[model samples]
Target: MLLAGCAGAPPAPAERPAAEPAPPPVAAVPGVGVEERDWLPPLFSGVEDEAHYYISRLPDRRFVTTYGGEEHPRPWYIAAERLGQIGEPAIPLLAARLESSDEYELMLALYALMLASQDPSLMAATGGDTLELGSVLDPRHNAENLALARAWWQRQGWRWE
Candidate 1:
């Protein structure tokens, strides 16, 4: 009777076969500029503001050194992307990297340039404003705008000298 009672106890609810390793826990770290809950290294301490912080932060000489340390780049090219988000702050470093960079790194610099300027370089060229490449590198239409920057910089009222 005891064995019968135990067997009938709902067959112990069929231990729900080990679930597909529940996805990694979302980081509890508070975000500063944007909600980058995942993809960040566990050791990375960042603010979630989306504007005041994040990769958009200004880059100094240190940026050159820092950007290179992250070598396994097939993923967060965005950090290299931070190069673009940081804008002119990123230019010197980006240009330097571009000088000797692999095809992928140049792509990152180009993407960053697109991000930091000319959100719509077209609109800016038409005179409504200017493109912030840091804001638009990921778009498909940037080639035209980049050409514009190269071709028309003199007319924009600044001498290369």
Candidate 2:
């Protein structure tokens, strides 16, 4: 007896959807630096909008000031404050900042993570105090501390502590 179950026709291949067009680039003002244009809010915006402008610029590592307050803390401090204010959304960015080569950036990122998480214990686990972290130029210590902090965050699975 001949088996009639074998199919003669192969199934047609699935068609892929067409790629969508890319969105237009954000318009930057002429003569303004790219970082400035991106982070500096258009003049006359509210304070919160202005705060966001500075917050958005944190990754640049160049912008160091935002309007307001007599203290005028360093740019890194401003970035940390903003990141802390941003909370969980800032974690991955702060985590990525953990890899920064600049000492200030690395410290700021770690501090930001701590502040954003509202956990002082994280600093202790990082193997140094804020002073040591900010002052130590020893790459070895820095790398080790960074590794410890990064490992902690990794172990925590990057969730807020």
Candidate 3:
């Protein structure tokens, strides 16, 4: 009678299968292989406001280094892509950066500016043409392109406002 009573107790609800162990939590240590979240430059630290912060980061070398860093796009490149998506709003900032940057930085600035503006003349006059080896080695044509771009911007200052 005791055995019969024990058997009737619903078979102890059958032992449940053991669940798979959860994956280890991912922890990214700062300055290790992981990129930092607060990657904004010191130049943009005192920006007028949030809008200007985004504008200021557009020209920062740390945000968008040259194409030789890694196989994957760097954090700055991704940020530049986001800035490019903002279109005309990015132009004045990019223009200012273009005026001040060096050749490699100029390449990055002009490329981002061209993407942000998508203006045909700016494209035709600057991005469309390739700088030869000598031109790349020098800033003469880059200066010319800068002047041309700035001139165009001056002509269309009304649009920028």
Candidate 4:
């Protein structure tokens, strides 16, 4: 059904639609550096915008979370994965996350800190009163993981209790 344009006066001047301005193009991230879109910020600047977004956004709702206990692989495993990508920038977040009650999350954070031990700030984080963790670095309890931690410590020239 054709609707008549006004029979009265000249048809209203054909309206010109306003043109949308194009958004500013972003500069590409350097090749040596991590791609901005590829990682959460600092790890990949201008990417995720916030630090630890990768770790934070993981499925914490899972019945088996990264914070240890009966769960075979906790949600914090992803945090551990992202931790390796973050380098020294991940130190503060990992350090802060270490304070949580979840042993899995806390252990993952500690493990990440071990990987990023080159940063001096990590020393202070490791020097805390009591660490919530999966297993201590004592060989008597869990020999394999303890050995791994010991090796990691020796690599970083760090001593943990």
Specify the highest-lDDT model's number: 2
All models: lDDT?
0.41, 0.56, 0.52, 0.47
Displacement of residue 18 (Cα, Å) in model 3 is: 7.9
Off by over 4 Å in 3: 1-9, 12-51, 58-60, 64-79, 101-105, 119-141
Clashing pairs in 4: 65-74, 65-75, 66-74, 66-75, 66-76, 67-104
Expressed as tens digits, the lDDT of each residue in 1-161 for candidate 3 is: 44544545555677899999999965553222234344544343322343256555644556643343667643435444544555556676766676564565565555555456664554464554322122321345576666656665666545557
Output the better candidate (2/3) by TM-score: 3
Every model's TM-score: 0.33, 0.43, 0.45, 0.36
lDDT tens per residue, model 4, 1-161: 99978778876888999999999976464422222233324444433343357457432534122344476643434445555455556545555554456544545556655555544455466563222235542223343444454455454433332
Predict model 1's lDDT versus the native. Answer: 0.41
lDDT agreement of model 2 with the native: 0.56
Worst 10 residues of 3 by lDDT: 129-138
The candidate, 3 or 4, that scores higher on TM-score is 3
Point out where model 4 deviates above 4 Å: 1-50, 57-76, 118-161
- List the candidate 2 regions with Cα displacement exceeding 4 Å: 1-56, 59-62, 65-76, 119-141, 158-161
| Clash pairs for candidate 3 | 63-76
